[model samples]
Target chain A: MVELVVFVLMGGGALAGGVTVIKARNPVYSAMGLLGTLFAIAVLYVMQLAHFVAAVQVIVYAGAVLTLFLFVIMMVGVDKEEDVRETIPHQRRLALALGLIAIGIVVSLVARGRFAWVPVASAAADPQATNGTVQALAEPMFTDWVLAFEATALLLTIAAAGTIALASFRRPVADTAAERTGV
Target chain B: MIPPPEINWFALLPLLVLGLGAAAVLLVDVQMKPHPKWLVRMAAAVLLATAAGALLQGWWLRRLEAGETVGTPLPFSGFLIVDRYAIFGTLLLAAIALLGLGAGQRFIVSLGRRAAEAIALVLLSTSGFMLMLSTPQLVMMFLGLEIGSISLYVVAGFSRQERQSEEAAIKYFLLGSFASAIFIYGVALVYAATGSLQLFEQQELLSRVAFVKPGVLLIGLALLIVGLAFKVTAAPFHGWAPDVYQGAPAGMVGFMAAAAKVGGFAALARIMATAFEGYIETWATVVAGIAVLSMIVGSFLAVVQSDFRRLLAYSGVAHAGFILTGIVAGEAGIGSIWFYLAVYTVQLVGAYAVVAAVSGASSAGSPLASYAGLAKRQPMLAHALTVLLLGMAGIPLTSGFIAKFGVFQDAFRAGFGWLVVVALLASVVSFFIYLRVIVTMYMEEPLEDRVLVLTVPLRLVLWTTLAMTVVFGLFPVPLLRLTAISLPL
Candidate 1:
């Protein structure tokens, strides 16, 4: 009964947040909505007993990424509500039609119980036996997957250097020359 | 307590060299702050050294093949394999990077103080792609793809002076991230269905057991194809290619386009031929359909492009189609696909080098009119462009012809003759697209008094690529022999 109630609350929150993310007229509100959605998903992850993943979901997606989104929105000064005019031709209608089709397909699939064959986590006999803990993850990450883990460092290095190269401006030669002359 | 997996130091030496080179360049850039020319020279030396490491690995592989030593090709707990196929791909990627750096010296220099950053990104991206080609694990491949792609996203926007560059970067990042998400979801679905992430394990499991839920597996396969198709710029998924190609700084556009194609196709071929070899009947038809659409759409759109960069972008789409046709022949056509990629990418880099030289390295777009009377002003560049275009057009006596012929032959043998027919018709249509550019360069009057100049490095890159095109066209036996020896293990 507790599990059912928790599922209902989190799922409903996620859905509401998702809808608000799309419907919000202000960019800041949209970002907040996204944060809510991310938080709700993180809660769902915890409910699934994926504790590490849930923690990462909150710490990374909700914490860092959402903050970055909010920062960019503020930096861009998009505090004002956006114009609600349709930008693309028939975009709304097309979106509505596509959404309807998607929902219909999903509903029909649910109605037909097509997902009945999906194996439940309970089938594992002991969920803890599968070792989805942080230790289990770290073991492979350091042992079998060490090369891939090291490669991620390379990726991060590239990203850091690349961001600097793309965003930062070089000191103008004129300024340096003037400074040298003055000295 | 489980023991750690054994390390294969010898097999990983080339990647280590590349990683060290990237770090060394960054360190030197900060510590010594060398002149731009010295930086370029230092980067070149590092790339050459990395290439030499790959050569040593290749030599070792050859010795192993000759029964001089006993060794298993699978390395790193089956996460990566060091076979002839991986070596061939590594060597090809290294060569392309070397040529790109050589031709892109001017562009790098144009970056002013950020020259080191550009060089570092190139090396890092190459390492990512090299890793991508060597890995058999799906998750590892995804990481490699991200490393390469995220670096490229930044490289595309390196020219901060131009709004178009930023636009290109944003478009590429958004679409590319979407593709990555789709790809990972596919990986998840596949994992859920087969309970394996390793390609070989997946293959073994798939062949042994009849899947209870085949729909999930099939959807996973389709999504994988879609994700990779987006990467390779196959038709319908190629909408971002032209804009990105045209907007990116000219010097590196060639490298970015060529490297992505090489890496994407290598991974695609590996997955399709190895992991899904059991489902060839289903996949071959789907791949053929994509091939036909790509060829027709690419050729038709390329003819209408007035922008030179966009034209090459569309032409690349057509080439992707041609490669896919080779892929439709399954494992039997991997050699032809590699040959086509190796030759076509060299030509692509060389052609874009000319574009870079003519339009200035930092220029965003190359209007077709800029090439009017190019022959009169820069005879060497014009002649080189002519030969390169001819090669791309698949004219006789060019490498493109042999590459096209090889794939078409493989496709024919595999009973994809109808797809081949469509490809042939599309190739004929593409000839006009190349001819239009050539005629503009040779016959039309000069639009402005602009002079075309090629630096020594750029000249060397062009000549080498052109020579390779002709040499491979006439006597493809050497390359063919090498490719035959490098079949996926």
Candidate 2:
């Protein structure tokens, strides 16, 4: 019952936070809301018994990625809300209708279905038999996914360097008046 | 109690060649830079060489069965299939990648720096594309997709000139990542129900499981379709296409649109043909719905577009819809789809080559208005573009028409006469849009001030492709026969 209560709280918190992230008027507030959602999702992951994935979610998404998001928001200095594009009211209504229908379908699926938790046999559970911890993950990471992982790092590095090059090449605007007067 | 299948290195040789080539090119680029401006060209040459090698290897492997060499399912535990179908597709992809390399040279020079990296990325993406075609497993499917997509994200913003390019790149990245994440989650759920990632295994699981599992599986399959359909730039997920295509360098856009769609659809075909065969009735309906929507939306949106690249982007989406008509029809679908993609690659690259040659003293490629006096100035390019436009319209005496005919023929053979009707309607709509460009080129009065300067190499490529398009259209029997044959899904 306690586990069920925790799962419910985690799911509810995450959903609420995600909605707030989109709905918040302030950009900073939205980022904070995203952070809350991310944390809740991490906790939900733990509840699902994906402990390693839960930890990675907390560290990578909530800790590092969110910090980067926060930094970018500050750097951009989004002081006021940008003027909203005047989308048709009917579009909003249509989107809401679609959302409600989707929610209804999902709810019906859950309510009608008798989903039993059939735990996989422990022998079949660990894809890697000898070491089923982080070491197992590492073994595959180093062997099978090594090239792809290296490529990911390379991609991130190149993105960083490219961003820097682009950011640094911002030339100052020439004075039009001075040029006109030949000063 | 059976041991898992062993890895099949020989079957995966094409991907290996592409990967090794890219690494070699990267090393060469880093070592011998700043001295030769043509270092990029040299690397491109190496890629072409690798592509040639892969083609030869593909031919050898494909003919192995004919020669009575032992041929069975690869021991990669069904992660990949080693068959004539995949080999042929890979060979075609290699040729397209090579052509893209040749066209990308001037565009990369215009961008300035990272030319080597861009070339390497293309080769890498080609490798991913090869893997995508060969794979029967979902995990590798996602891996190959990311490899192609991430490369394209960088390639789209290769030029730093316009804010639009940056915006295009970011939008493509964010939307693509989100879609892929959704796809992965769906895969996880499917795996949870099925206990295996292989399509064949999943099919067995689906058959064994009850109705509720099938329902969940259907939802998961829908999500997979949505994600892949996005990659292929089907209408609903095609919001990024036009802006991204316009903002990206013409060569990259051409390559990505053609090769990426081929890879995505290859995997889509595999999924539908194998695991989802049991749910064919369900998936067929959904796929047909998407096809109809995509065809209507893409062609209609393309018709009014002034920008040539953007129009082509919309047209690409429309072609994807047409292709999906075949995919929806199932087993009878695969051959025509492959044949159609080959025709598409040739025609799209040819069109973009013409665009690259024509586009101006201003940017990477030409504007629609810029083509006004093109017939008067650069008759060769105008002629080539006309052929390309005709092919795209599925006009008589062009490869596009042959391809469309093949697909429609397959649909009818598969007992899908109604689908053929819908496809026919869509094709007629597409014809109008494709003709719009040609009409603008010929019938409209030439704008007095514009002068077109055509590059010799681009003109040569254009003319060659135009001839091939007409040739294939006329003598399509051989290709048609080729399309009639099928390999394992």
Candidate 3:
């Protein structure tokens, strides 16, 4: 009964947050809605006993990523109302139809009772259940997936260097000197 | 406690060399004064060395196979597979990077101080794609894709002074992230269905199980196709290609396009042929539908594009359709697909080299008018472009014809005769598009006295690509044999 109640509340909150993210005129409001949705999803993850994933979702996504989004929104100055004119012909209608089709497909599959909302537990104790803790995750990450782990370091370095290269412009020496002299 | 997975350093040498080269280039850039030419030369040397490493690995694998081998080696707990396929992909990616950087020298030099960063990003992107080609695990492939894609997003915006470049980067980033998310969702669904992330393990599990709930697995497969299709710029998912190609700096656009195609298609082929082999009947028809749509849409669209870069983007879509036709034949067409990709990428880079020379390297919006009287003003570039365009159009006595024939034959053998017929018609229409450009260059009078000068590196790229095109057209036996040898293990 507690699980049922929690699922209902979190799912409702997630839906509302997603709607607000789409409908809100202000960029900051949209970002806030996104944060709410993320938090609700994190709660859902926790309900699934994925505590590590839930914590990371809260910390990395709701905390860090949402904050970055807000910072960008503020820097870009979200005072003006966005232009809501449709650029492509029939884009909204097409999107609506496609969305309806996708939802229908999912609903029909669920109606057929072929799509399980929760994973079926095995007769034996689940290895993954015991290994859901941080230590178990870290063991495979450091051992079996070590190459990928090291490769992530390279990816991050490349991203850092690429960001600096794309964002920072080096003016000619003459321009720098002139600017320094208040020209 | 679980035992630690065994590491195979020899299998990973090519990627390691590339990573070290990227770091070395960045460090060298900081320590010494920035000379774009010197940095490009250094990057080229690094790429050449990396390619050499890949070749050495290939040679070693052949020796192993000859001496004694029951099955292909799976290194890193089956996260990576070392075989002729991976080596071929790595060597091709390295070569494409070298050619792209070589052709992009003036553009990098134009950046003044950020040349090293540009070079490093190219190497990093190449390594990412190389890793993607070598991996057998879905998550590892995703990481490789992200690594390559994030670098490309930045590279797209390298000309920061231009509004269009920034727009292109933002568009690419938002859509790319969405696609990646969809791909991961598919991965999660597949895991839910089969309880495995490794491709081979998933195959085994799938074949063993009756799959009481197949809807989720089918949806997962569709999502995988959608994500990969978006990357390869297949029709309906190809909205970003034209804008991004037209907006990105001309010198690097070829590399970006070629690298992404090589990696994305390599992964797609592997996943379809290896993991989803049991569901060939289900996927083959779906792939055929996409192929038909892409060909029709790409051909008609190419005929209408006034911008040369956008035309090439559309042509790329058409070529992707051709390759997908081969893929629809299942594993039998993997060799044909690789051959098509290898030959097409070389010609693509060569064609873009001409564009980079005609338009300034950093400039966007290469209107077809720029090529007016190209033959009169710059005869050699015009000739090179003529050959390249002919190759792209699949004219007789060019490598493109052989590639088209191979794929069509594969599709026909697989009972996709209707698709092959549609593809032939699309190819003919696409030929007209290429012909239009050729006519504009040769027949149309000069708009202005725009001096088209080819830099030495650009010259080297063009000559090599051209020579390869002609040689492969005349004698495809060697390349055909090589591609046949590179099947996924």
Best by DockQ: 1
Query: What i-RMS does every model get?
Result: 2.2, 6.2, 2.2
Question: With candidate 3 superimposed using the best TM-score fit, by how many Å does residue A47's alpha carbon deviate from the native?
Answer: 12
RMSD of 2: 7.8
CA-lDDT, candidates in order? 0.88, 0.73, 0.89
lDDT of 3 at A66: 91
After TM-score superposition, the amount by which residue A14's alpha carbon in candidate 1 deviates from its true location, in angstroms, is: 15
- Chain A alone, TM-score per model: 0.73, 0.62, 0.73
Please provide, for model 2 over B381-460, each residue's C-alpha lDDT reduced to its tens digit, 9 standing for 90 to 100: 77888888888888988988888887788777766788788778878888887777777777766776555555544565
lDDT by residue (tens digit), candidate 3, B131-199: 998998999999899889888988998986666888888888899889889888888888888888899
Q: How many Å off is the CA of B320 in candidate 2?
A: 1.5
TM-score of 1: 0.84
Ten contiguous residues minimizing lDDT sum, candidate 1 chain B: B157-166
Better of 1 and 3 by TM-score: 1
Index of the highest-lDDT prediction: 3
Q: Which 10 consecutive residues of model 1 chain A have the lowest summed lDDT? A: A117-126
Tens digit of lDDT per residue, candidate 2, span A32-111? Answer: 99988988987766555566677898899989998999898888887956877856778888989999999998898789
Task: Point out where model 1 deviates above 4 Å.
Answer: A1-51, A54-130, A170-183
